[model samples]
Structures are given as C-alpha cells and as structure tokens.
Target: MIEENSLHPETLAITSGRPRNTPDGSINSTISLSSTFHAGGVVGYGRYGNETWTDLESAIAALEGGPTLAFSSGMAAISAVFSILPVGAVVTASNQGYSGVMTLLHTLQASGKIEVRSVDVSNSDEVLAVLPGTALLWLESPTNPTLAIADLPRLISAAKDAGCGVAVDNTFATPLGQKPLVMGADIVVHSVTKYLAGHSDVILGSVTTKDPALFSRLEDARKIGGAIPGPFEAWLALRGIRTFPIRFEKAQANALEIASRLSRHPKVDQVFYSGLASDKFHERASSFMAGFGAVLSFTLHSGVAEAEKVCESSKIITHATSLGGVESLWERRRKWSGESQLVSETLIRLSLGCENVEDLWSDIEQALGNA
Candidate 1:
C-alpha cells in the first residue's frame, strides 16, 4: 500500500481512496446503485452505507488529514453539528460568515435551543473576549461575499485554552488552499457543492475531524437525521476532487488578474480579494493559505442599478447565484433575501473559473463599461 501521508496533497487528490485494479482489471470504481445489500453484510442498506460514499469520504479525509462524513448538503452538515450541542449551549460565530449559516443560527437562537453570539472573526481580541462563555467558536476565514480574513492560529489557541470546541467553515478556502485541522481547529466543514465538486453539477457537504469522539457524535447525528448524500453525487464529487488541485490553480490565477484589474477600474470602489496586495486580508491570507482562492468581491461607485446592469452586461461571465463552476459566475449578492446586511447593495461577488484570463477580462471590461 502507498503511504498517502508522505505524498503531497496534489498527488493525494488523484491517488487517495482509489482502488487497485479489480479482477476484471477495471481502473474506475463503478457507482454502487443498489439501495439494499445482501443480508448479514457490512453494508445492509444504502441509507446507512455505500461503497461510493465510502470512497468519497476517504478521499476527503485524506485531503483534510482526518476522518470525514458526507451529507445531503452543506447546510445539513452544519445543522448536524449544531444538533449535537446541548440545549442552550453558547456558540460564537462570524458576523460576516455565510448567510445560510447565520440564518440557521438565528432560527435556533429564536427558539431558545442555543445561545448565539455574533462576533467579528477578523478581530482576534473580540473572538477571545467571548471565548470564556462560548461552548463552540465557529470560524469562516475570508468570509463569504466580503472576504474578511480571520486569524485562525490565535483564535484557535484561545478557544482551546478556554475549553471551547472550534469549527471552521473551510468552504471558501478549499482543503488545497488551507488546512484548518493543521491550524488546530477541532473540526473543518466544507460545502463540497462549491469548489470541491468544481463543476457545480452536484450538491454535497462534508465535515472532517481528528477527534474520534467528535467524529462519532457527528456520524450519529448524520445517521439519525438521515441527511446522507446520493451515491451519484458522491461519485461525481470524487471525480471532481481528482482534478481539484489543477482546477484551483487556474481559478486562483484568473481571480488575481481580475481583482487587480477591478481595483484600478474607474467604476470600481473597492475589490475584496486577499490576493491583492492592497486588500486588508492579504497579509493574513498570505501567512496561512497556499493560494488566495478563486472568489473575489468588489463594489461599484454607483448603487444597485449600476451593479445590476453590470451583472446583466456580462457576455462571457454568467450572472448567477451559486459559484465554483467551470464557467465564470458573478452576481449582486444583495439580491438574495438571505444575504447579510453587511454586504453592500452595490457589491458584486465573482467566482473565477478556468476560462482564459484575457477573455474573462474582456467580459468584465464590457460589464464595467455599462456600470
């Protein structure tokens, strides 16, 4: 057997969890479509277990450097974690994190199931101040839409000292860009529907952990909640992971070029990509991440009308909501009802793809001309 730990992540991405040649000399693992296995077998039912899911989970775990559990969607994985918390347990989360996470946290808080404290994750002092009373510290570095970077080492250390568990939403910075587990986080979460799947054809979420007890608890929650991913989705995600490193590299390069150009564009007010030297999070992002990621957000000098026009004016770039696809995507985030009020109405979030840099630039230039 090959030693996966000795190999680079790029190598692991392709080789990990792959089966050796079968009796028929097949290289690819076929999707197990059976919903029920034979009686007295290790996997008696599809809902409980499947070979396709196992392969996908193993691949994710190898990249994340821990054991992993897959769910129907990113929100399902997040909800499973929250469900494991005791009633009224205090959880501190990023104020500018993903809107879906915030909405769920707010709903839970309203019902008095948990005590939620929203804090600026970028500010280590603010995060530490609330740590004493917090049962869990939720982190989202390079936060959604805004791209605010968090100081994970400092916050994770403080949370550990305070005896609080730390969970980082590693959706924005994929495992290839950043490893939260190596940074001392207790758990790392990913919305595999995004970058991990790369093509945006599948919806899946995963949680990885080094702690056996926590992994057991999360697995129990997943099994009981019955929010497992489909076998086909898992297979597609595994295929996507095989090329994640290469896809991420191209996307990052495209994003840096786009962000640089947007920063100097006359109609642009500000660009929020950590790859840019002028970005507030650039320094912190450089210290921790292997790459600055593929997503970037910028604000227009004009208001919502101009932003909407820019979104509509794009020729090559599609104006869409979800991101991390093979083709470039951009949208005015405020149009979403669940978007954070912190995100400005004029802010445009862009998800760079593997498309040619010059072509993407031309599309953006044309869009900004209308703005």
Candidate 2:
C-alpha cells in the first residue's frame, strides 16, 4: 500500500501524493502522462481507470478521509449525485442553494423523474418538516451569496432518522475548514473550481463518502455519464491541492479582516461572513468549522446601482465571476444568480485570494467609497 505522512494540510500539500519512485527514494511524485495501461490482462482502452487517474483518485480519497471520486466539474459531481435518485424521489433543499443546482432540480421535477422543494436551510423546523418524505437533503451551509449557515449536526441527525440521504456542498468551507462527512453527512461535494484547485485553470468536482452504496451509485453515474477528468487535469488538481493548506490560510486571514472592515464601512449596508461575531452563521461556524472560510457577501449602501459602480470602479479588484484563486475576484451576486434570495440585488460576493490582506482591503475600501 502507498502511504503518505502528513500532519497539517500545509504539510499534506507538500508531502501528500509524493511516492518514493527513485531507487534511492525521490521526494516528489511524478506525473504520469500515460493515457492507458494494462489491466494485467490486456491494454486499457481509454481514460477510464488509467494509472495517473487512479493515483489522483487515491490521493484525493486519502486527503478527504473517505472514498473520493473525481469529475469533470463541480456540476458534474452534483449531477452525478442527483442521478441516484429514483424516479419520483423527493429532495428537500435550501432555497439558497447554488442556482445551477436549483435549476437542475427544477429540470428533473419538470421531467417527472424527481420532486424538489426549496426551503430555508438554517431553519431546523423548515428542513425537518419535509424530512419524512425527502429522498435527499441537499444542503449548503453559509449558502451561496447569502452566507447563511444551517445547523449541520441537527439536520444530519434528522435526515438520517427520516431515511433521507444527506449531501453537503462543502466548497465554501473547503475540507481545510469543514468536514461534513466526519460530522455525519452521507456525502460531501465540492466545486473544485473554487478552493480545491486553488488556481482557476482547472474545473473539477469531488464527492467523498463513507457509504459504499452511495459511492457505488455515484461511481456508476460518473462512468456512464462520461464526465471524468483527464489524467493531466486530475494531476493539476492534485498538485493545486497540495498547496490548499497554505493558500486557504492566507485567504481566510484576509477574509476575516475584510469582513471586519466591511461591517464598519459607512457605505456598506450588510456584511455576511461566518467569521463575524454579529453574523447569524457565527456560532454554528465557530462550532463546526476549523476556520471561518474565505467567501463573503455584502450589500452596498445604494443597492443594485451602487453595486455596479463598485464593480466597475475598482482598479485593483477585477469585477469577475468565480472564486478561490491566487487573485481577488468581485461579482454582483444578484446579477449572476438570477434573483434568487441567496443573492440580493445589492449584494457583492468577494473571494479573497493569496494577495496581501492590506492591499485587498485598500482596494475594497476605495471601491466602496464612490458606491
């Protein structure tokens, strides 16, 4: 068995996936560019089950502390999970879940293959009310754009008792900060496009689970759906993952300071950050997250119009979509999310990067000035 020794994520980022390949034992793991290999019977036919891909899978599985599978994108992983639901199965989810996911559910419901109901994920009562008939409890704590956190442990307990499988979008928190599987969730999904890759170059997704049944179902969906990542992309994601600990730490430090400063800004109306003491998500995050995380949402003093101004006026901050890279990103949430309550007309989403905290804040403070 190939084993890796890692104590901290920073350590893991450097040490993980590195095998002793040289006769004298080299320190780094080599990237295998091979597209196919022998199964000890015949030549491998395609990208499916390639050596490099399998090595990437093994590294990810080891890091997540569960059996993990890679996919083409975060949406692919999510869609693979939805593929498991039987016809007419019901999924109770946060109304604020990712818009793409909500759209996927709606599409399924429209096709008569599934039923999806949206509700406030933070309200235990709201979620529990539908648990009995729910086939899946789709959850996103500190939900997209709104930064609303659900009572994860409570929901997991209730969902299990009701015979509903639970899946948590752990992207916002990243595994560096949160482990939903360890906290009783059946499946943990991530848009590796965000924090996991740490770079914007690769779009990937992952699902980690202890349940073999759930793993088998998702694995089948992955193989049959033909959404597997290329060996090189997987290699890139694995490489990016090694630096996750350090990148995550720096970004989070910047985020906490940014959130603190934003709350006090005269031009800011609302700031949503789990790290904020005043935030609704604070207590839950304090208890559940290893770190408060880097993503945040806030409203400008002037709402939508001001939001557009902030996006365009900033020189250092780029008004763009997407998060979890080495550079700062800013986006008007409402415009991108199509009016879901998760993203308000006045809201701006910021994904803090590895840049100097002082610099990022200076840009934000200045941008908010004219807004």
Candidate 3:
C-alpha cells in the first residue's frame, strides 16, 4: 500500500484503511458479525467493538488526521460528546446551527444538566465574549440552512486561550474540504449518513480527535451508552467513502453554478453561498477550505407560499429534508417545525448532487417560473 499520509485527500479516500491481502487476497475488509468473542481479547463483545467498525473508523480517522469512533447516528455521536461534560457544564454553540443540535441543547438546558448559550459564531467578538469560563464551544461553519461561515481559526484561538475545548461539526465541509484538527479544533464530528455514505442508505456518525484522552472518553461513552453502529452500516459507510472525493467535487461544482444562477435570477431576493465571490464569507472560506461545499440557500422574492410552490414544481430535484446524497434535494427551511427562527420563511435550502448543471438549472428555472 502507498503512504496515505503523504498523498492528497482524494487519494486517501480511495486508498486508506484498506485491508492487507486476505487468505484469498480479497480487496475489501470482511464484516465480522460475532456478538461475543473469546475472553481476554481486545474486542470481547460486539457492543464494545467490531472489525468492520474498526476499519471504518480507521479510514475516517486517516482522513481527519486523528483517531475516530463511530456511532449509530449523527445525533448519537453528538450525544456522546455531550455525555463527557459534567452536570451544569457551560456550552456555547452557534445560534443558527442544525435544528437537531439546538433541540438537544435546549432539552439538556431544560433538565438543568447543562447551561447553553447561543451566539453568532461568525462574529469573532461574540464568540470571544462567550468563551470565558465555557466548558465547550460548539461550532458549525457555513451553518446549515443559512450557509453562514464562522471564523473558525479566530474562535478556536480564543477558546484555547480561555482554557475551553472547541468542537466543530464538520459534516458540511468533510475532511476533504477542511481538517479541523489541523486548524486547532479539539474535536471534529461528522454525520456519516451525509457525504460519507453518499448513497443515503446508511445512518451513521463519527467523531475524530487528536487527543488520546478525548478519544478514549468518547469511545467509552459509545460503549457504555450502547450507541454503536451495526457491522453492516459500518461496511456500507466504508464503501460509500471510497467514492467521496469525486462525488464531492462534482456536487460542489454543481452547487457553485446553481448559486451563481440564483444570485442573478429575478425571483431571488438573496442567495447564500460562501463559494460566490460577492459573499461575505468568500475570503475566509477561501483561506480555510478546499471547497465551499455543495449546499446553498436562497430566499424567494414571492415569499413562503411561492417557496412551497417552487419546491413542489421541481421535476428532477427531490423535495426532501436531509442533504449530501447522490441526487439533488431542496426544501423550504421553515417546513421543518424545528428549524431556526432566524431561517427566513422564504428561504429554500438546496443540496446539489452529481447531476448535469444544465439539466439541474432547467428544472430549477422552470420551477421558479411556475412559482
């Protein structure tokens, strides 16, 4: 095998964590389905570990430049991180982050287990103001739905100076786009269900950390909490990751094209995408990431009713919720009850896929025209 560390991310995605030659010289790693192993072994029980899960974790860890632990779902991985916090811990998070994360924080706050403070992570001053005495600073750069980019380096630096740990949700910008550990984040989280498992068939999550202690704690939490991914899901995720590089590249290209068109459309009030030259976060994003990612949002001039009409009128694009699949998806953000109030009713979040740019544009244009 080649030295994966010296190679680029696109190369690493194809080559890393592959099994050595088996007895029959099989290229893919075998999925071990044993529930219990012999006593006194490294993996005594299935809940604790699996060969398939280990292979998947190793592959993702190689990409993230750290050790990784896999979980049943993205929320489970996030819950594992929060499980490490002591009762009454103070956590500062993005005000307009993923709705699921915000709901979890609110639930914990309601139970009095943790105190959550929400802030605009893009504002360096606001982030710095909340960092003092904070146990953890949770970040989601190029935030979901809104596509607002956070000043990660600045926030990470200030958090470190204040003796706080920083965790970045790297699902939007996969390790191929940005390496949070290299940029000084203490932990990086991913929804493997998204880009990592590009087919949208598997539901899994992972967390990677450079710190050995943090990795151990998260692993322990996964084991004790029984939030482990099945062998099949791990195997599927590993398979999906093999083509991530090319899929991401194509999707990002499509997204940039779509965003450019949307910005000039008469029906569009505003387009939010870091990839655009006119975007406020364009410079910062260019400085930090390999690409601006495949997701973008735009507000319709005709408002919420028209947004709904456009979503229904689409022929090629799927009107769905989650993103980062091989097929394009778009939805009105406010359609989800849990979506942030900051996300305007007219805003439609688009998740570009590996579709032809002209075909996608025609579908969108027709939908907009009909609306």
Candidate 4:
C-alpha cells in the first residue's frame, strides 16, 4: 500500500481511494446504488455506508489529513458539529459568515438550545474574550462574502487551552489552500457543493477529523440524522476531485488578476481579496495559507442598486447564488434578508472560475459600465 503522506496532494486527488489492481481493469469505483447489502459484512445498509460515499470521503480525507464523513449538504455537516455540543452549550461564531450558518446558529439560540456569541473572528482578542465558557469556537477564514481572514493558529490554540472544541469551515480556502487540522483544529467542514466539486452541478458537504472519538461521534450523527448524500452525487463529486488541483490553479490565477484589476477600477470603492497586498487581511492570510482563495468581493460607490445591476448585466459571469463553478459567478450579498448587516449592502461577491481572465474582466467592465 502507498503511504498517503509520501504523495503530493495533486497526485492524491487523482489517485486516492481507487481500487487496487482490479481484475476487471476498472480505474474508478462504481456507485453501489442499493439501500441494503447482503447482510454479511460491516455495512448492512446504504445509509450506514456506501462504497461511493466512502470513495469521495477517502479522497477528501487524503487532502484534509484525517478521516472524513460526507453529508447531504454543507449545512448538514455543520449541524453535525453542533450536535456534538451538549444542550445549552455556549457557541462562539463569526459575526459575519455564510448566512446559512449564521441563520442556523441564531435559530438554535432562539430555541434556547445554545447560547450564541458573535465576534469578529479577525480579532483574536475579541474571539478569546468569549472563549472561557464556550463549548465550540467556529471559524471561517476568508469569511463568506466579505472575505475577512482569521488568525487560525492563535484562535485554535486559545480555544484548546480553554477546553473548547474548535471547528473551521474550510469551504472558502478549500483543503488545498489551507489545512485547519494541521493547525490543530478539532474538526474541519466543507460545502463540497462549491470548490471540491469544481462545478455547480452537485450539492454535498463533509466533516473531517483527526480525533477518532470525534469522528465516531460525527459518524453516528450522520447516520442518525440521515444526512447521507446520494450515491450518484457522491460519484459526481469524486469525479470532480480528480481535477480539483488544476481547476483551483486556474481559478485562483483568474481571481488574482480580476481582484487586482477591480481594485484599480474607478467605480469600485474597495476590493476584499486576501491576495491583494492592499487588502486588510492579506498579511494574516499569507502567514498561514498556501494561497489566497478564488473568491473575492467588492463594494460599488453607487450602492445596492448598482451592485444588483452589475450582477444582472454580466454576460459571461452568471448572476447566481452558490459558487466555485467552472464558469464565473457574482451576486449581491445583502439581497438575502438573512445576510449579516455587517456586510455592505453594496458589496458584490465574485466566485472566480477557470474562464479566461481577459474575458471575465471584459464581462465585469461591461457590467460596471451598464450599472
């Protein structure tokens, strides 16, 4: 057997979780596509385990450096993390992050299930102040929409010292750009619906952990909550992982170029990309991350109306929700009512894709002009 650590992640992305020396000469694992097995082995039912989900999970675990479990959606994986906490547990999370996560946290708080502490994750001191009684410290670096970077090492260390579990949403950074587990996070979650799949075609989520107890707990949560992914979707995501490295390379390159150009554009007030030296979080992000991520956000001088117009006017970039597709996508952040008020109403979030940089920029220029 090949040692996972001895191989590069790019090579692992293509080669991990594959069947070894099959007599049928098949390279890819086929979808099991059954609800029940023959009742003779460890996995008796599809919901408990499937070779397809296992293959996808194994590939992600290879990148994340841990055991992983796939969920029906990113939110499902997040919910499983919360499930680990005891009733009435105190949870601290980013004040501004993925709206779905924020919404779920607030909903739980409203139901008197968990006490919520919202803090600026970029500020270590602010985060630490509320950690004493917290059960979990949830972090999202290059945070959703606004792209604020966090000091993961400092926060994770403090959380551990305080006896709090640490969970990081690595959806934005992806496993390739950053590894929170290596930084000592207890758990890492991803909305595989985004970058890992590399196309907008599938919806999936994952939870990874180096701790066997935590992994077993989360695996039970997955099985009990019935948050398993479809066999076909898992197969599609595994197919997508084969090209994850190359796709991310092209996307990040386009992001750097587009963010630079957008920063210089007259109509743009500010660009929020950690890749740009002018960005506030650039230094922090560069200190730990392998690369600045592919997503960037910018605010328009003309406000929300113009932001909406820019999204609508784009020809090449799709005006849509969800990201990390082969084609570029952009959206007005505050259009969703649940979105954090901390995010500027005029902010337009861009998900850079593997499209030609010049073409993407031309689309942006035309959109800005029309707006």
What is the per-residue lDDT of model 1 for residues 177-244, given as tens digits with 9 covering 90 to 100? 88899989999998999988889799999999999999999988987899999989999999999998
C-alpha lDDT of residue 115 in model 2: 92
Q: Per-prediction TM-score, please?
A: 0.98, 0.93, 0.98, 0.98
Clashing pairs in 4: none
Model 4 Cα lDDT, one tens digit per residue, 129-224: 999999999999989988998999889988999999999999999988899999899999999999899889998999999999999999999899
lDDT (Cα, tens digit) per residue for candidate 3, span 1-371: 85767888777777776788668776887787899999988879999999899989988988899989999999999999998999999999988999999999999999999999999888888889878879999999879989998988878887888999999999999887888899899999999999998988999999999999998999899989999999999999999999999999999999999999999999999999999999999999998888999999999889788999999999999999899999999999989888899889999999999999999999999999999
Give Cα-based local distance difference scores for all models: 0.91, 0.82, 0.92, 0.93
How displaced is residue 4 in candidate 3, in Å?
Answer: 2.8
Worst 10 residues of 2 by lDDT: 41-50
The positional error of residue 242 in candidate 1, measured at the CA in angstroms, is 0.9
Instruction: Give model 2's TM-score versus the native structure.
Output: 0.93
Off by over 4 Å in 3: none
Expressed as tens digits, the lDDT of each residue in 143-235 for candidate 2 is 887888888988998898888899999888887777788778899988888887888898888888999988988887887898888777877
Better of 1 and 4 by lDDT: 4
Model 4 TM-score relative to the real fold: 0.98
The runs of at least 3 residues in candidate 1 whose Cα sits more than 4 Å from the true structure, single-residue gaps closed, are: none
